[model samples]
Target chain A: MIQLTDVTKQYPTKSGPRTILKGINLTIRKGEHVGILGRNGAGKSTLVRVIGGAEPPTTGTVEREMSVSWPLAFTGGFHAKLTGIDNLRFICRIYGVDFHDRLDFVKDFSELGAYLYEPLGVYSSGMRARLAFAISMTIDFDCYLIDEVMAVGDDSFREKCKVELFEKRADKAMLIVSHSHRYLKGTCNRFLLFRDGTIQEYDDFDEVYEKYKELLAEPQTF
Target chain B: MASNSLNSSSEGSFRQSLVVQGRVLHALLIREMLTRYGRNNLGFLWLFLEPMLFTLAVTALWTATRTIHGSDLPITAFAITGYASMLMWRNMPGRCINAIKGNTPLMFHRQVRPLDVYTSRILLEFGGSSASFVLLVMAFWAFDAVALPEDALQVVVGWLTLGWFGAGLAIVLGAVSEKSDLVDKLWPPFSYLLFPFSGAAFIVDSLPDKAREILLYLPMLNCVEFIREGYFGTKMHAHYDMPYVIVFNLVLTLLALGMVRMHVVEADYE
Candidate 1:
């Protein structure tokens, strides 16, 4: 189980302290699939990072008993002059995986083909995304946290990701952050709408998503 | 209870996997050497040659001075041996400090520990500098220019001490550099100041009385003196204390390792 008790994060600014998350009391049980829906600048990414252990909460305790994987943001590792195959092997070595099995999986799933033996830095943004996604999905984790999931790669890659990860890895708990209601509704049964400085959970995603959209659509003169 | 998480079956296996990732660090070091020096015909040959050239220049200049501390030893053999060893002492620490910032991309890999990056650079610096020393010694022997050390084991011990000292310094410098950008400004002048006290061009015994008393206690001076003693077969003008260097480095290394654990984790903060 993962629990956040009375979490509050504040960042200092020229004006004063800007509060991000205030008194965020939450618990996620095993095998729960969750979608976190929030507009830009609503602390969605910060929540994901904190849960992933990439960052610590400023004023509250985050207790995690399960392994967590955060969505990959960048692809390049050291020795950019090396080929994609070489880089994969290097990463596998670091991660302590048997090179043959992981290598085959990455080669097949990433679809880099002849480009596999060429320098990875030369690969396009989509190719890099595919490679990062393929590697991250192959790692088994109890909790997978994703941010801006719909923005990467193409439509086919997205569908392929859903089939390979969400479908195949159903027993694992997941937290997906995205603005697309259609994708969230299809993939996630539960939703948390982040607004102002706290998260509000809703068993009915449609109801929460509608309210979230309505709130976002109406702009003020402030 | 805390230990249970660390001792999990998967965690044990995961920790074991880091050993494999350490090799990637070696590959990165090779890339660092090549990219910095350029892939010319000379390639890595310069790693050996640079120290040798410094040794040769220092030897010639000191030889012209006739006598050092009224000792009759050939200044060429004395300076060359000491100077070459000092390179190993000096370069490793400086390079290790910059290792993390240099390979920032590798930090994203869960398996690539921060120390692994520094360790790779340390290994490369030691290997290159050690190779240069050996090559220079062999060249001198091939031409019947100088005699080998009387106690080969003592020379090896000296080299190891110098190496650890360098690693310790590098670790602390690396940690401090992350917090403050002052390392970039301080590094050049810091290295320049190290030159006079390094026991490179002259033996600790040869420094005029007052300077000699202070220089003998400096960390690398013992190793330099020890290496020179091995080559020259006698303790020329002063005796060296080895225990001081070892103890000081061990404490410094432990402190550095702690600081690294704390500061390095901050880099990944979201």
Candidate 2:
């Protein structure tokens, strides 16, 4: 379970302090899938980071009872000079899992074959995304942070991921951030919309998405 | 692990935090080694070999100009002791400054804190320089080019003290450099500028009382003087106060950890 109470996050800007999340109070229990909807610059990513324990809230508290994965498909964390195999080993080491056990799984899942022996600097974006997804899946986390960054690979690969995540590990908690209403509607049991530094909970997808469309049409304002 | 009553990782127990840090450091150490050396010929052996080669060249150069080194001390021994200590204190900070900026991606993992990043680099540096120093000393000893130190215990203590100083400085500067661009720009030149006064080139015993007093204000100089005393024993008079060096290291470590905790925010996260 993850619980956030009176959480606020802000960044220093040249003009002044820019607040992102404001007094956010939330609780996510086991097996809950929460979809987050926000336009660009509305702090969906920050909220995700805060929930995953990657970033501390500016004020108030965040309590997590379960292990949280890093943002899915975040290739940024892998060292470019390390081969795909080495990077996989590194992830395994940090997560306190055996690398040899996961080696075959990743090799089979990522489909990189001999390329896994080559440096990540040599891997294309699609290859990197595949590698990232494969590596993160090796770790067992109670909650998975899914940013839109996961929107990669071909349709078949997406289908494979759907089976792995939505079907295979459907009971795990997830906080998914994306602009795709169809995807969110298909997967999430709960919804939160970000506006004016606060989150408004919505149970009805059609109602919240309609509000989201209206928000998109409105003029940009802080 | 989750069976414990404590739910929040941020507020997790001390033992849990330590285990996590150890795991992160192990992962980071391997990552640092591979990224630094790559799959090229000789690879991570360059860790020791690079420093060893530098020391050997300096030893040869000093031997060629034997008369100019300002003391009757064996140039090879002096070069090994002096250059190895210098390499530790010098490069650790260089590796640390802007470390977080280069490693912003790693910060995405909640387990990879700023201290782990600084420590992994410092450990790699300490290991490389120490291996180089020990290898050079043993190799030269085998060849009858230099005698081993008179007091091995004192040498070990002095080397550890010197390492503590480097790690403290690196952590502090690494944290500070993230907040200001000036630190990144200034650190390289400052490291070079410190070389002459760092007691890496000349013995503290060779200097006049006044000059030695002034130079000893620098901690690395005092550390080398302590080490040289271990090496040369009664042959050379070493000037150092262990208490002063220890206190400085303790305070610097406190300040470093404090600054890292207080100052490091998420780097460029939107």
Top-lDDT candidate index = 2
lDDT of 1 by residue, A9-67 (tens): 76666788888888888888778888998778788877876666544567787777666
| lDDT, candidate 2, B186-214, per-residue tens | 98899899987898788877788899788
Q: Estimate each model's TM-score.
A: 0.80, 0.92
Per-residue lDDT value at B105 in model 2: 66
Candidate 1 lDDT tens digits, B1-88: 1111212233334444444444557555655565555456486778767766776776676667664534667655676676677677
Candidate 1 residues lying further than 4 Å off, grouped into runs, are A4-26, A39-42, A56-63, A76-79, A195-198, A207-222, B1-44, B56-80, B98-112, B143-146, B265-270
Chain B TM-scores across candidates: 0.85, 0.90
Q: Compared to the true structure, candidate 1 yields what TM-score? A: 0.80
In candidate 2 chain A, what residue range of length 10 has the lowest lDDT sum? A48-57
List pairs with backbone clashes in candidate 1.
none
Question: In candidate 2, which residue ranges exceed 4 Å CA deviation?
Answer: B1-18, B39-41, B265-270
lDDT of predicted model 1: 0.71
